[model samples]
Target: MMKKAPTPRTALAPGIAKVLKQLHCPLDVMLMCVRWYVAYGLSLRNLAEMMAEPWIEVHHSTVYRWDMKLLPVLEKAFRLRKRPAGKSWRMDEMHIRVNGEWRYLYRAVDKNGNTVDFLRRAHRDKVAARRYFEKAIEAIDADRETPIKIRRCKYLNNLVEQNFRVIKRRTRPMPGFRNFRCARILLAGIELMPMIAKGQMQCAHGTHPSADDQFYDLVT
Candidate 1:
């Protein structure tokens, strides 16, 4: 029997390491704190208190600043590092309330649970759905990758709906977002968590020297 060839890993972007150097906290600690808030949808105040259990003292406002600073770094790093998703796109839309009125959240993922993309729209109509469909197609099309078909019906489109279900569950802790821009950013974070859980995103691991180096060098 022949051993399978190893898959090449994506290198961390140089900009990430450069920016992280000027920060005051440890890389692992900062990553852990921001991940908890993003993964669990904790309020900044709640996150600050939670960190206190481990003797890490930081204010809620500080946590807010950390998220603002760190999320874009992690988000871009993960996007560049993750593998291209499948071509069969499963897509859906659901209404979420922001500032007292409803809005449409368009979400789609490939078969392997890799999120294609998400968009928050002010209306839900043919034009909106079509726009989302085009975006989903664009997202899934990578080098040598073309989305073969779109699956919007419930039968084969459970992935996006399930993602929405998780989003709905996780978001219940926070009553509402202040505005659509903030709401979209939070939803994007929520969507990214699943990819990380699936082992499909940029991860820092001790056993992997390259990624471990990137993470340490950045966070230090």
Candidate 2:
């Protein structure tokens, strides 16, 4: 007898397989919930309610758990295949409330407005700025021997500032994040959404890839 084709679960990447081990939900459904949560301005309750329309029984907290578990895995996969950023960079910070206190979200984009990288920190001091710069350089897979020049003019930073509005709009509806860890995971996913939409990921699909295709490419 011929062997049966490998099941979707069996075909998943080892990292995804490990994270999803023992989960009762179908893989597509779980991924759908995670995608909708980060790609749109919907809360967990909103996602749970939406799923009920299709008769999928899932609790908001379950979705939250999925976010915490799967997002890091997904983000790591995306980073490996991410396209390099442009040389001219713009960086800035946005204020986000977490656990009833303010936190700094440092973000940067290239001149073309592609996302470079992001970091969340408690303080907006020089150390935090330095760390963000380091992270962005690493994210772009830059050559360590080449020095990167940073432009400090206020007018030159509008590209990243505009990018910040997209993130803020998505985060506004939810109640503030419960803690820093939760905020970090969710924010990374949130940052990831636009990058996918803009086709910043290198995939088999040519220049423009639909967000869904890119997301599945990362996970599977």
Candidate 3:
């Protein structure tokens, strides 16, 4: 009998491959960067070092670029928009270091521990609060299916507070981020994993055919 020919790797979707290749990185590297950034709360430099390998070179600048470019896009793509409004919303703040100084992260979540919005501000004063609420409320207005009356519910807020711990563990190895934009992207990627793990997003496991293959299969 003749030996079987080797099967070729399927081509991925243009959009998916474009983004992945634009950063001069692999999907696993991109995913790992996000994971370490969010799960450990590590700075870009730390993550770069941790991800560095004998074959591939990992640098702090590369981490910075990945965060600034892809993190927000990932967040917007994966973020949940419409949900039944909870009776109340909870807001809180955490401090992280940027450029060797402390900065605050203001976050809001619904009654169900789902993220509403987040803001990074210089201080936690009334102005900062106003800014955070403005963006959060705007997001709620745009995404909500029904009108939700606001109430003060600390318990709901506590649920949202739980996110910090998970990211903190990941950050411990690196300590803090040097670039704020990169830091934001890292957070978005990190936050997205839970949603994916919970079966909310369709992940591209290597075993499956590429998006292009699916399209081609459909078209053909």
Of 1 and 2, which scores higher on TM-score?
2
How many clashes in each candidate? 0, 0, 7
Q: Which sequence of candidate numbers ranks them by lDDT, best first?
A: 2, 1, 3
Among residues 3 or more apart in sequence or in different chains, the pairs in candidate 1 whose N, CA or C atoms overlap within 3 Å are none
lDDT of 2 by residue, 135-178 (tens): 66675455656766654599988889889988999899989999
Name the weakest run of 10 consecutive residues (lDDT summed) in model 3.
211-220
lDDT by residue for model 3 over 1-220, one digit each (tens)? 3111112244543444456557676655654565445544467776777766535578887776765665565555454322333446677877777667787777766656655556777665757675658666677678768865655556666676786665456555655666786466665666555544433433355545432222122111
TM-score, candidate number 2: 0.90
Residues 68-138 of candidate 1 have per-residue lDDT tens digits of: 67676666666777766667777788888788788888877777767766778878875777676776566
Give the candidate number with the greatest TM-score.
2
Runs off by more than 4 Å, candidate 2: 1-10, 134-146, 205-208
Question: Any idea what lDDT model 3 has?
Answer: 0.57
Task: Note each model's CA RMSD in angstroms.
Answer: 7.4, 4.5, 7.6
